[model samples]
Target: MDNCLFCKIARGEIPSRKVFEDEDVFAFHDINPARPLHILVIPKRHITSLATIADTDTLVLGRILAVANQLASENGSPDGFRVIINTGRIGQQEVQHLHAHIVGGPEPVGPMLKRV
Candidate 1:
């Protein structure tokens, strides 16, 4: 994982505009945001993708979501926000790491919730 982008970000080797961080999770603004309030919430430990998550990883998964919730609430979208987890290449999992994309904006965000 030494050469991984997100791993580097988690280790602070690569600078990112961090929004939140804790013992198990880290969040930052997406470099290429699709929405005005786009942030990427990821785990400190690399898990490849959602397809690779194990039963033991459930706790971390929940923590990722909790962090996303807090981030969304803090970003002024307590009532509206989108949590997206792309699983594979077809789903646009550009980075080989488990991360949740939290998107919200002042405009109507309902259409961005289209199921993939």
Candidate 2:
């Protein structure tokens, strides 16, 4: 996990525009945002991806979701937001570490996905 980008960010080895941080979770603004309000919420402990999550990860995982609303409302997009967790290859996960992206703004984010 030493080399994992999100772990580095959680450990403060890398700088990020942090939105929220607690004993178990870390939320920060995405450096390259896809939406007007975009944030990345992650666990302080490294978990490869959602595909690799274990029962022991429940608490941390729950904590991630627990803080999403507050993080979004405080940062922006109080009306609503989208929480996305891209898993493995098929999910188009760009980062190896498990993280949920909170995206929204004054306007809708458009359709969840395009028709295949």
Candidate 3:
């Protein structure tokens, strides 16, 4: 994961608009946001994607979700927010690393997805 973008950000090799960080997790604002409040929460250690997670990865995974509310409220979305974790190619995952997107704002984010 040396060349991984998220790993770089987690290690401080790349600069990001960091929102929250702890021993095992890092949260930051997305450079290209889809919503007024958009943040990416990732694990400090690299995991290819949600599809690749092992049992040991559960703690960090849960930690990411556990902080979503606080991160959303502190950054902008006080009322509520949406947490999305895109997996592999079928999920339109832009990055290989495992991460969850916290998206929301003062207004509703609209429909979760267009009807199929």
Candidate 4:
């Protein structure tokens, strides 16, 4: 996990435009915005991907979504928001650590497209 970008971000070893952080999670702005507002919500501990999550991770998973929700509402998109978790290679997970992408805004959001 030493090479994991998200882990580095979560650990504060690398700088990020952080929005929220607690004992369980770290949320920050995505370097590349897919929408008017884009943030990445990730667990403080390193978990490879969604496929790697165990049943005991349920609470943490819910916490991630809850953090995402609070962020969307607080950040000015009260009407709605999108939470995306890319699981593996085909899912376009550039980082190996599990993270959720929270995106929303007044502007129209686009469909998920494959990387070319």
Every candidate's lDDT: 0.91, 0.92, 0.94, 0.90
| lDDT comparison, 1 vs 3, better candidate | 3
User: How good is model 4 by TM-score?
Assistant: 0.91
RMSD of each: 1.8, 0.8, 0.7, 2.6
- In model 4, the runs with Cα more than 4 Å from the true position are 110-116
Name the top lDDT candidate: 3
Candidate 4 per-residue lDDT over residues 1-116, each given as its tens digit: 88888888888899999999999999999999978889999999898999999998898899999999999999868888989999899888888889999999976466666689
Candidate 3 TM-score versus the reference: 0.97
Give per-residue CA lDDT, model 1, range 1-116, as digits (tens). Answer: 88899999999999999999999999999999888889999999989999988998999999999988889989967777999999898888989999999999777676655698
- Model 1 alpha-carbon drift over 4 Å, by segment: 112-116
The CA-based lDDT of model 3 is what?
0.94
Candidate 3 per-residue C-alpha lDDT over 1-116 given as tens digits, one digit per residue, 9 for 90 to 100 = 89999999999999999989999999999999999999999999999998999999989988999899889989889999999999999999999999899999999999989998
Tens digit of per-residue lDDT, candidate 2, span 40-112: 9999998999889989999998898889988888877899999999999999999999999999999999999
**Number of the top TM-score candidate:** 3
lDDT pick, better of 1 and 2: 2
Clashing pairs in 4: none
Better-scoring candidate (lDDT), 1 or 4: 1
Candidate 3, pairs of clashing residues:
none
Q: Model 2, 30: alpha-carbon shift in Å?
A: 0.4
lDDT over C-alpha atoms for residue 37 of model 1? 89
